[model samples]
Target: MADTLLTAELDETHTAPTFAELGVREEIVRALGEIGIERTFAIQELTLPLALAGEDLIGQARTGMGKTFGFGVPLLHRIATADTGTTPLDGTPRALIIVPTRELCIQVTQDLDNASKYLKNHQGQLRVLSIYGGRPYESQIAALRSGVDVVVGTPGRLMDLADQGHLILGKVGVLVLDEADEMLDLGFLPDIERILGMVPTQRQTMLFSATMPGPIITLARTFLSRPTHIRAEEPHDSAIHDRTEQFVYRAHALDKSELVARILQADTRGATMIFTRTKRTAQKVADDLAERGFSVGAVHGDLGQIAREKALTKFRKGGIDVLVATDVAARGIDIDDVTHVINYQCPEDEKTYVHRIGRTGRAGRAGVAITLIDWDELNRWAGIDKALGLGIAEPVETYSRSPHLYAELGIPEGVTGTVRKAKVERDEDAVVVERPARAPRKRNRRRTRAGEALDQTEINSTDGGAVATSSDSAAPVDNAGTDDADENGDKPARRRRRRRKPAGEGDAAADNSAAVNGAADDNAEVRVTADNGGHDAETADQPARRRRRRRKPAGENGAENGNGVAAEAAATTTAATASV
Candidate 1:
C-alpha cells in the first residue's frame, strides 16, 4: 500500500483551485491576492476546508509543498471567525504555534503575519508575535502584556515564559505543532507534553510533518481527537523531482572543496547552497569557498542569532552568492531563487537527502542537485538510493579534474578552481555591508619583573632619590653588618670579592685576625667588616659591583675569579700558621 501511494501520479491536466473557492475569508483572500497568490496547492486544497471547519487534522506533505499556508490559512480564519461571547479580548493569545528551532519560529511567524494583514479577532485587528531564544525576554513580555492574537515560538522559550506567568495558554482555541518529526528528533517531547497539559483539553489541535513516523502517530493519537489524516501525494513525475537534474559521484574527501569551487563556476549556476553534516564542516566549507573568490555566507548553530540573521538577509537580498549550512539550521529555509544545491557530505537518511535537495528546484524552477560521496559513506548513500528507487545504485567514480565533470555540469573550458581575475577584482572592490559591533572586553592587569622595575623607578622619583634602572639593584642579600657576632662568637666576614685584583691581597689583613681567633679557640669577638666601613656605603656599592661583574668578558675573568677564591683560602691558612 505504501509503495502504491508513493508511485501514484498527480493529474497535471486538472486546474488548480483558488483560495476563495476553498471558503477562505474575503480579508485573507485579499491578502493572498496582494501577494499575487491566487491558486492553492494540493496540500492547501485538501486540508484548508477540514481545518476551517474546526476539525482535528494531520496534513502530510513534502517539505516545500506549501504546507505553511495549508495550515496557516485555516488557523487565521478560525481565530477571525470565532464567537466573541466565549473568546476573551483581555490581552490573551487565541492561537499558539510550537516549533523545534528558532529559524522555523521566525519563518512561520512571518508567514502568518503576512496572511493576517486584514484579519481581525473578536477584540480588534489581529497581532502576531514570534517568541524565541537569542532575543531579550522583556520585549516578548511587553508584547504579551499588550494584546496578541497569535504566538509562534520554540518549545523551550514558550515554556519559560509560561512558567514565569507572562504567558497564558488557557484561552488558546487553536494549537499547532509544525514539523512534528523534527521536534521529536530534537528531544522536545517532554516540553511538548507539558505544554499540552497547560492548554485546555477542549481545544482543537493540528499536527503536520513531512513524514509520519511511529512516534508522530502516537503523539497525534494522544493529543488530537479523532483527527483526519490527509496526505498530499505528488505525482511520481512531480515538478520538483523532474525539474531538478541530480548527479551522484564517489569523490575523494580531500578534494571535495576543489570540486565544489569548480561547480560554482558552472554556466547555469546562480545562488547555491552547500549542505554539510556538522556545524564545523559547514563553517570550513564556507571559508574555503570565500577564499575561491565567491561571496559566501555560513548559517550554523555556533553563530550568534544576530549573525545568522545577517547572513540570511544578505543571501535573500543577493549580497552573497553562496550559503553553507547544516541540516538542522537549513530547516524552514524557503528561498525560491536558489539554482543549485550541493551535498558536501552524504546525508544520514533518505528523508534528510530529500529535504537537503528540496532547497532548490522550488516554485517550478529548474535546478541541479549534486551529491559527493566519500569511500566511508558508500553504505549510507546506497540505502538512500534503494529507498528512492533511483537507478544509480553505485555512483560513478569522479575526480576534481575529470573531463566528464566539466562537460556534464556545463562548465566552460579551461576554467580552474579559482574564479576569473576580472570577477575577483569586481567582488574585491564591491561595497561591504557592516553590522553593529559587539562591546569591547575588559582585560586584567598582570605583574611582571619589568613592571616591578618601572614601579621602583616611579617610587624613587617620588622620593627625590636616584632611581635604580636595572633589576640587579633589587637583588636580596644578607645584612651581616647589623649583627655583631656569629654563633661561635666570631663575626661573619662581610668583605666584597674583587674580580680584577687578587683575593689574597684584598682580604689578607681581615683573614689574619680571624685565623688567629679560630686557631686559638678563643672566645674573643672578631668583626670582619667591609673596607667601605658601614651599611650605607656597602648598600650603595653593591649594585655597581654586580654591574661590573656582569660586564666582564667570560673568557679570562671567569678563570681569574675561581683562582682568586682558592688563593684567599690558602692565604688564610698561612696567616693561621704565623699566628701559631
Candidate 2:
C-alpha cells in the first residue's frame, strides 16, 4: 500500500490517500494521531516515502505547510533505529535538526518528540532537547550532559554550544536544515558550515525551504549527493490573500507612529500586530500605544525567551489590544484570529511584506493588511512593488486627518492626532512655573607677589624717560648738603679732609697719605696746579674710581646710617691691616 501511494504520488495516477492510507510505520501514524492530524497534505504525501527510504530529496512549499513533519518523521524513525544498535558516545544523538529562529526550534522539537514517543528500547534510553538564544545555558548544558537522541536549535546557538564543548555532533547520521532560505537571509551560512563540519562526513542530508534561491541551490548541490528534487507547487494562499485587503499609505517618518495609533482606535481593529523595521522602533511604538491607554505588548530579538513567550501569549489571548513586533516574530506567529496587520514601518522587500501581512486573514477569515510608509521609505517600497509585481508606483500620501482613513477604519475624525491634555484649566487650578537652569559662577582670586611687581613695572615704563630716574640721585643730594662750616660761621681754614678709598685699596690714609701731605705743604703749588690742568685730572680720576666701588654697596645699604664716621674709620684701619 505504501508503494502504491508513493507511485501514485510520483506519477499522478491516483489521488493521494489520508495519512491513515499512506502506509507510514505504525509508530509515526500513531504519533500524528495524537495531534488530530489524520490526513497528509500533498507535499507531505509526495516527500515522506522518499525520505523514509533514505533518499536525498528537495521540497518546495510555502510557509505554514506540514513540511516539518514530512522530513521530521523519517529523521525520528532513523534516530530510534540507530540508537538501538549502538549506544552513542557520552549520550550524543544520531540526529540533528537546525532551524532559523528560537520559536521554530521549540516548535520542531515538540513535533520530533511526539514522533519519537511510541518507539521501543524502553526504560529511559532516548532523549530529545531544543536549545536557542535568549535563555540561560545552564539547563541546556545539563541536558547535553545527560544526553539527547535528537538536537534541534538555531544555527548560532547550536554552533555556540558545540564550539564551547557543551554539545557533541560527531555521530549524527541524519542532518536536517529546515527553512534553509531564511538561514541564508539572516547571514548564518558561515555558522552553518561550522556545524556541518562537525557531523559525520557521510550522512543522510535533507534540505527543505519555501523558495530555493540561487544560494540555496548551490548549498544543496554542495551538501547532497545526486539528490532527487521533489518540487511541490507553492501552497495556494487560500485563506490569507483572499480575505485581506492590502493598502499602502505614504506619510512622514515622524508621523508613522501617529498613523498606527489612529489605526488602533479603529473600530475594526480587534487585535493588531504592528510590524517595524527594527527592534528599537517596535519598542517605541508599543510604548507610545501604551501611553495612549491601549494595552500593548512587544516582541523582538532583544527580549528574554520568557518575556517573548509571555508577550506572544498575551497577543494571542486578547490581553494586549496591540502588539508591536519585527520580522522575526512575523514568521513564527501561527495564531488564527489576528484581525489587522499594520506595517508601522515599510519592510525590506516584498517577500518580507508578504510575510508581515500573512499573520492575519488566516483560517478562512477576512482581514486587513495596512502599510504606513514614510517619505524616506518610498524608494524602498518601489523596489518591493516591482519585485512582487504590485504595480503601485506611488502610494497615496496620507495624514492623520485623512477622511478616507476615518471612513475605512471607522475612526472618528477628531481623534486621529497625538496630543497631551492638561490635567486642569488655568482658572480652576493654580499653575507653578519652573525655574530655568543657572549659569556657572566665575571665581575671583588675589594676585601673587611676582604678578603685582610685574604690573607696577609695566605702569612705570609706559611713559619711557618720564619715569626713568637715576638710581644714584639720592646719594648726590646727601653729599651736597653735608656741613662744611661750624656753628659760629667763622672763616677758620678747614682741616684737611680725607679722600675715600677705591675698591681693593684697603685704607684711604695709606692709599693717598703722600699726596695729602704734599698738598698741605705746597698749598700755593696745589692752587696754581688746580687752576691749570695738573690736579684737576687727578681729582676727576679719584671720584670716578670711588663711584665704581660705591655702586655695589649703594643698592645694598639703601637704609643704612650715615653718622658713624668714628666707627667707620676704626673698621677701615682694621681692614687695611688684615689685607696687608
Candidate 3:
C-alpha cells in the first residue's frame, strides 16, 4: 500500500538474507558474490524486494549502511530485459540515478558496475555512465551517443545534458535519488524537482537519505506518490555510532596539529581521515601531515576535479594512508577501511558531525574518532554534543603531550612526534620556491652652468698682474678701475658694454675693428694718466671709460690731448677705408 511505513527491520540476532534468497537475479547475485557480498545489509534486505517489484519507496538509513547497493541492485535488476521482460536495450537511458556530489556519483557508478558485471542484455553488459561537473562535455556527450543503459550523475550535469538533448530521459523506467537529504542540504531541491519533471511520470521512483528532515519528507510526499517509507534502523537504535569510539578533547588551536600527529602515530592506527570546516584548513592539515612524512592527500573545493579524484583514488588503493577533506568535498565518501577519523576543526552542527565521523566505522567495522575542540569552538561543539546526546559537554582539557592522549589512542610511550621527520626536505610539503631578486638601477646625473664652459685655468687666472713668488715679497694688487673689487683676493666681476659683429673681409668691418681697437687704446691711456695724476681714490676706482669720457670732452686734458692725435689718425684711416 502507498500509505504504509514498514517498520520491520532485521535485528542483530536474526540472520540477514542473501541476494539470491531475496529473489535477486542469478547473474546480479553471482556478480555480487564474486566480490564477497553474499548477505544483504538490513537496508538492502528490506529495499530489494520492493525496489525489484517496481514500487516507489523512500529508503532511510544512516550513512555507510549499504544504502548504495540497497537501491543500485534493484535498479539494475529491474532494468535488465531477462529479469522483468522489459523492452530490449537501446541507446536511450532506461534507469536514471541522481546523486548530490561528483564523488558520490562516481561511488554509485562503481558499485553498480561491480554488481552488474555479469548481468547483461541482448546487446552486451549493462552500460552505466557517470556524468558530473568539472568534466568536459564532449566525453559525456559521446558516452550518451554511444549508448548507456543506466546513467548515474549529479543534478547539475544531468540537467545540462538533458537541456542540450544529449542525455535521453524519456525512456528511463526507474528513477532514483540517492543521498536525498544531502541534495536538500546542498540546495538542489529545485533542480531535483526539475529532474523529476523530466523523467516519465509512470517510472519507478525511489528516494534514499540518511536523515529525514521536514523538507525531505515534504519532498517525498509531493513527488513520490505516497511511497513506502522503509527505515533500515533497528528498534530503539540510538543515532550515535555503536561501534565507533569517540573522544573529544579541549585542545588549543595552535597545538591541535601536534595532538593529531601523535594520534596518527598510535600503534593501532590504520588508514586515517581528517575533516575540517573550511577548504583552506583541509589543505593546511594535509600539508602539515605531509611534512611529517605521512602520505597525505587533500580533497576540497579549491582542488580541481582531477586532483580530487586522484586523492580519493589514492586513498582507497592504499597509496596514501591519510586523506584531509572538507565537509563539501568529503560528502558521499564511503570508505569502510578508515580506522580513525580526526576532526581537525569543528563541524558546523550535529548533522555535519554525524556525516563526518560516519566516514569511519563503516561496513560493520569498529572505528576510533577523535575531536579537537578549540576554546572559541567550545560553544559550537556544545550544541552539537547536546544534539547528539553525547555527555562530553565540556571536553577534557588536553594537550599533545598529555599522558591520557597517549594512553587512549595507544600511542607508544616516548614515541617521537615526527615519525619520519628527518626526510622533510625531500617531502612534497617542504618545497619553498625562491623568487629571483631584482638588480640595482644606475642613475645618470648632470652638472650644468648657464652660458660658457668655465675651464679650471680660466677660473684661477685673471687679467690682473701676478703676485711675486715669495710670500713676504708679494706685491699688492694695483687694480685701478675694477667695477667691484674683492678684498678677499677674488677677481672683480666684469661685463662688456658693447656687442661686436663677426669679422668679414669688407673694408667697413676693417674700419669698425680699427675703431674698437682705438677705443680700447684710449681707455688704457686714460687709466695710466689718471693713475699718475695724484690718483683720486674715488675717481681712480671709477671705470676708466667714465674718466676717458670726461677728459675727452676736456679738449686738452693731458692723456686726452695725447690720445686725441691717434684717435684723429684712425678716424682718417676709417674715412679713407669707407670711400674705398
Clashes of each: 0, 0, 0
Candidate 1's TM-score reads: 0.73
Each prediction's TM-score against the native? 0.73, 0.63, 0.72
Q: In order, what lDDT does every prediction score?
A: 0.76, 0.68, 0.78
Which candidate would rank higher by TM-score, 2 or 3?
3
| Distance from true location, Cα of 70 in model 3, Å | 0.5
Candidate 1 lDDT over 481-525, as tens digits, reads: 222224442222223433233335535444444443333322212
lDDT of 2 by residue, 1-580 (tens): 0112121123335465666576566787787888767777667888877777777777766555567888887777666666323453346777888888887787777777777678653436457789898888899999888777788999888888988998888778888988888899999998998888888777888888866789988887777766777655533322225568888898888777677778877777787888998989888888887787678899887788899888887877888767888888877676667899999888997778877887787644778899887888889999988777666769989877788878877887677445453465466466788999999975532224655533322322221111212333321111211223333333221223334444545433343433333333311121111111112222232221111112223324333224323434434443443342
lDDT of 3 by residue, 329-399 (tens): 55677778999999988888898898888988988899999998999999999999888888899999999
Better of 2 and 3 by lDDT: 3
Candidate 3 is scored at a TM of 0.72
Residue pairs clashing in model 1 are: none
The global Cα lDDT (0 to 1) of model 2 is: 0.68
Which candidate, 1 or 3, has the higher lDDT?
Answer: 3
